[model samples]
Each structure stands twice: as C-alpha cells, then as structure tokens.
Target chain A: MNMKKEKQSGCGRSEDLVTYLYGEATPVESSDFERHLKACAECRDELTAFQSVRGTLRQWEMETVPPRIDIAIKPTFWQTVKELFAMTPVWGKLAFGGVGALALLALFNVSVTVGGGGVTFSAGWRPQPVQVVTPGTVPPVVNPVTPVTVRTTDEAAVRAIVAQLVRESEKRQAEQLDAKLVSLTSKLDNRQRAEFVKAVSQLKQDQRLHLASLIQENSRRGGPDLLDLIGQVQSASVEVEE
Target chain B: MQTLETTDMQLVEQTLGGEPDAFGVLVRRWERPIYSLAYRMIGSDEDARDVCQETFISAFRNLKSFRGESKFSSWLYRIAINCCHSRQRKQPQPDVSIDEQIEEYGLEPMDSRESVDDRLYRDQRAQLVRRALAALPHDMRQVIVMKEYEGLKFHEIAEVLGIPVSTVKTRLYTGLTYMRKRLEHVSDSL
Candidate 1:
C-alpha cells in the first residue's frame, strides 16, 4: 500500500511536471512543482527523457517543398453568370422568370379574341423603339410605351427560331457527312480502277501465253495450222458420211 | 504582392479580396510546419505533401467562413488534423521502415567529432524513437506530435483536437510515459 501510494505520487508529479514544462501551470502551481521537482529525482529524469524525445522529433523536418502553382480565382463572364444563378434562391428565380414571361407577352402583342364561333389566341411581334442613353448625359432618354396591336400567339415566332437553329445545325452536320462520303467514294473508285486494270492485264498476259503455245505446237508438228487442220478433219468426216 | 512580414490572416484577407497569390504566401508560410506535422502523423512523404496541399486548399475554400475565433495557425492545425483523420479512415497506416525514413531524410549528425560507431548508434537511436512513436495509439501519437513536435500549448492542442485541456494533459502524460517505456525496450533490443 505504501509503494502504491508512492507510485501514484510519482504519476501525479510527472503530470504536474508536464503541465509546468508546457507553461500551462499557474505561477503558484509552478513554484510548488519546482520545489517538488528539486526533491523528486524520478520527475526530473522523466522531464529529461521527454525533452530528449522532443529533440529527436525536432530533427524530423520538411527539407524541400515541391513547386506548386496557386490556382487563381478568375471567373469568366459566363462563370459569373453561373455563380449568380447558383446563388439565386428558388423563389427569386421564379419571380424573375414570371417577370420575363410577362414582358415577353407584352412585347409580342399577344391577344385573345372571344368571338361568336370560338376564342382565338394570336400574337404578332414588332420591334419597339429603344431609347439610347449615352454616358455622362444630364437626363436619361425615356421612350413612352407605344399602343399594342391585338395579334395572334407568338409561339410561331419562337418555334421558327428554334427550328432555324435546328436546321442550321443539321445542315452543318450534313455538309460534314457529305464531305466524308465524297472522299470515301473517290478512294473506293481509285482502288477499283486499279484493281480492274490489274485484272485486265493479267487476262491479256494469259491469252498471249496460250497463243504462243499454239504457234509453238504447230511449228513442232510441221503440219498445217490449227484452223486448217480442223477444217480438213471436218471435210473428211463429211465425205465419209456421203 | 507579399512581404516577409505578412501574417496568415493578412494573406487570407488579400486572397479574399481578389488577390489569389496571397494564399500562396500563406501556403509558403505554413507549408513546412504543416508538412512536418502530416509526415509525422501519416509517416508517408507523398501522403504528407498531399495532406499539406489539401489543408491549404481547404483553408482557402473555407476562408470566408472563418470568424477568427481561434488563431489562424490553430485553425490550420485543426484542418490538417481533420485531413489526417480522413486519410486514416480511407487507408490503413502502413508500418514505416527505417530504410524508408533514412532514404527520405538522412540521419542528422549529432556531433561533428562523433566516431562512426557513435553515428551508427545515433542513427539507430533515431530509428528506435520513430518506431516507438509509430507503435503508439493514434490519440497518444497525435497528442505527442502536437505537444512535443508542434510546440502547441495544451489549451491550443485542445482547441485543435476539440478536447478539454485536462484531457490534453492526460493524453500527453500517458503518451510520454508509454514512449519512455517503449524507448527503453527499443534500446535494449538494439
């Protein structure tokens, strides 16, 4: 029990020593710990050991740093626009969209006509007069709202724009595809012509060899030519029949 | 633009004010200590560099939210420690070899007039210390590294680790005691 008590005292003293070494202990507590440290050899030894460990750790270092470039926050105009969109709340987006739609309807001169037969919706878009204001002007230019014409629905104009865009893209794609097809066709034509010429030359060479062999055979036999020989054989057969 | 006297908070402010290179100044300022902390924590040079870079990037991204409740360096330490925790979760800590440690950083000569045997002994002792440190539990190692290596105050360490000051003291005491025994054993083994 006495030894266990001493062990606890040693643990507590070491804890206090660490607190003192790190300068966390109060002045009074440090004084008391310092007095105790003078009396306690075990605590002093532990302190030395910890300091040694720290010295070893201090040896570990970052010798060199790999070069790295800092990424600059350079937002493009589109990126700024995107950031604005991202920061906007859902209600704000809806409000802006509603206002834009109302302005678009007003700009297009959209109208609804309720007649005896049925109700008809129509719109006709006309260019509105724009008040141009230069910088540093005393008063800004303001154009009064012009009277709107009751026209049909403006969906046709929007559809026309969309369709035109689609047609232009399709036309560009078709041009690219047609160019590729033409190149491929020319390549195929060249290859086929070369192959045809090669085949024709081969056939002509075979025919010349056959003719030459026939001439050689006729000369070796020392008899009439092939055609004459056949003619004579035909005549003799005819005579036999007669 | 930067000067040698620019503080981390000043660099952060400049970075927030549309000067991107200012953050690089902060990075250069704290890079070594941060890298050393990471290298000691994770025991891998590559991972330590990655953590150091990541810590700076995280600090940059979260700069707007910083309320200056703590020291800027302490905040960086917190972020770095958190990063080390995240890395620890993603991968197991591999046992670092003495050769690898030597290859990464050659042993420091303790004395100019030391003989070859003394140099070898010192090198072996350094390795023994590292191995003993690596053998410690994670919390103990963290406390030891922060308190001993980083020279952070107990309260500052508590702030970084989000623990109480008493717990910091307890951990430090426990870690030192454990390391003392381990070092004794390592000395005997060598």
Candidate 2:
C-alpha cells in the first residue's frame, strides 16, 4: 500500500519535477525534489526525456527567417497629407477647387486696375462698377476712337448686375458652406462644439477684415460708401445666429 | 551588439518614441523563438512564417495597447498563439503537408559537420519527435512548446496563455506523459 501510494503521488504530481527542471522551484522545493529525483528512477528518466526533446527542438531552426520583413516604414507626414487629399470625398474636392478658384480670382482682381479703356476683366465682382458701354447701348461711337463715350452703367443696371453676380457667388459659397455643415453636423460630438465656435469666430473676423478693406477700397475709388453693406452683413450674420 | 543586449522593454520604448528601426531590433531578437513556437504548434514552415510576420505586425500596430502588464515576450507569445489558433480554424484541419514535414525536420550542415548517415539519423529522430508532438492536443502542444523550446517559466507560460500556473503545470506534465508514450522507442534510445 505504501509503495502504491508513492507511485500514485509521484505520477500524479510531476509538477515539482517540472518546476525544478525549469529552475523555477524554490530552494526547499528544489532540494527536496533533487533528493526525490535521485531516488525516483521514473522522474529522473522523464527529466532526461524532456531534456532530450528540448535538445531536438533546438535543431529545428528557421533555416533563414524569410528576410527580415522591415515594415515598409509608415508613410511620412507629407505622404499622409497626399493620402488625405487622395481620399477626400468628391464634394470635398469640389469645395477645395471652388476655394482655390476664388483665391485666384481675388489675386487677379487685386493685380488688375480698371482704367479708361475696355472693361479689363471687370466681370463685376468689383464694388465700383466698371463703366461698360455695350456696343449697342453706346449710341454709335460717333468719334470712332473717343473711348466709346464711356458712361457708368446706371445704378439700377449696376445693382441688378451686382445682385446677379453676388447671387451666383453666394450660391457657390452656400454649396461649400452646406458641405462643411454636413461634415460638421455629422461629426457633432461633444468635443467638436468648441472647435466649431472657434472656427465661426475666426470666420466672422476674416469677413470683418475683408469687408472693411472693401469699404475702404470703394471709398478710395469714388464708389458707393457701402457703410450699410457692413450693417447688412452684420444683420445677415444675426439672422444666421437666430 | 549593443542592441543585442538592450532589454525588450527599452527597445519597445524606442519603437514607440518613433524610432521604428527599434522594432526591427525586437523582431531579430524574438523571431526565432516566435517562429519555433508557431512551427511546433502548426507543423508547417510557410504557415509558421506567416504567423511570425503577423505576430510582429500585430505587436507593432497594437504596441500602444501593451500596458506593460506582462513581459514583452509573453505579450508577443500571446499574439502568436492567437494567430496560430486563427490559422488552425481557417484550415479544414491542421494538415502538415509532406513538403513542410521534410523542411521542418531537414537537418542542417553546421559546425558539427556530421556525416550523411549521421545527418539522416538525426533527421529521423527529429521527425519522430515532431510527429509525437503534433499528435498532442493543442493546449498541451502550446504549453510544452513555450516551456520546452521557448524556455518560458511556468508562470510566464501561464501569463502568455492567460491561465493559472497550476493549469500550465498540469498541461506540461500531461503533455510530457503523452509524448513519452508516443516516443517510447526514441526515449528508450535516448
């Protein structure tokens, strides 16, 4: 019975042997297990077999680790930017293109000065209306080279022209604003409200500066005062706020 | 040479600090153990290679999630073992193709410079050991591989497998017993 019991315990609890083999058993456990291993032929033989298996495993080397797979280093910042542009939505691309075209138009208008010649790209975005005399409207250019009898287009005509041009420009601007609104509202989480507020304030400041400069330029060019245009802009902003 | 001695955690910090090459250091250091574990678990060279690459890639991507809760190698082992499990599931069964079997046990002509007959004898012994191991259950195979080949401590194996150390010991003991029975002739010869 004593021999049977020892056999059962030895076979059932080889964890001590495993711990000792792996050098994990504590001092007492190690010494005790070492003594036991000296006497226990079965345990000693099993340890040897496990060791032999470990040796065999050492032989199974990865002949050559399929060439060090250097992770194609993550794209640089500019590459990430290029990827962002490439991934931008179609509406986003259109909005960017519209902004770019508007910037170019602003640069062109800033560069060219209206003189007493032909209409010189004065496609009516200027606050001061160019005195364009349509060939039919000019009453026959009697002097042939007398500057075609330049006359400021009537205020109603200019206002109508300006209103139409402003409407188209506003339409394009509204499309971009609508795109931005969709994007912003879709992402309207708690964190974005502060960003939205900052963005709006910055936009209003930019508009204030742009309109102030336009008012000054219009005054210098002997055009409409446009002081109420500022009020109109402020009131329109108030309407948006409401 | 300096990097060879750098600790895994120090390399990990370097990798996270934007020196991506540091990860390459970690890979070179750990690839052998990881590949050995994968090959022993799956019994296929190509699949093991796939698992090895995937393990490092995953570790790199999810490096931030590594909260230092365990040893870096244990964490890597966890990823690799998970990859093995996934690869096993995708296959109809873990079928060790003949080519992989030959490649897996094929002996190398290193410094020992054993004769052709000696190399063939060692190859046969290795093939027997691998077959015996492959016959064991997945849990038993993993515990044995980590403990025997990777030299992971019982607790480390437990941590890698997310089991109790007691369970690790039980599996290792049970697995060794199973391998002993299957490899009786080889064990007797040894």
lDDT of 1 at B5: 90
TM-score of each: 0.52, 0.52
Model 2 chain A: which ten-residue window has the lowest total lDDT?
A1-10
DockQ of predicted model 2: 0.13
Cα-based lDDT for every prediction: 0.70, 0.71
Provide chain B TM-scores across all predictions: 0.80, 0.82
Candidate 2, superposed: residue stretches over 4 Å from native: A1-12, A37-67, A76-242, B1-7, B94-116
lDDT for model 1 comes to 0.70
lDDT by residue for model 1 (B1-190), tens: 8666977778778777766778778887788788878877887778888898889878888999887888899999999998998998899665544345444544443443554586566555655566667766678788888887788888899988888887777778777766665454443333
True contacts kept of 1: 0.23
What residue pairs are clashing in model 1? A122-A151, A122-A152, A122-A153, A123-A151, A123-A152, A123-A153
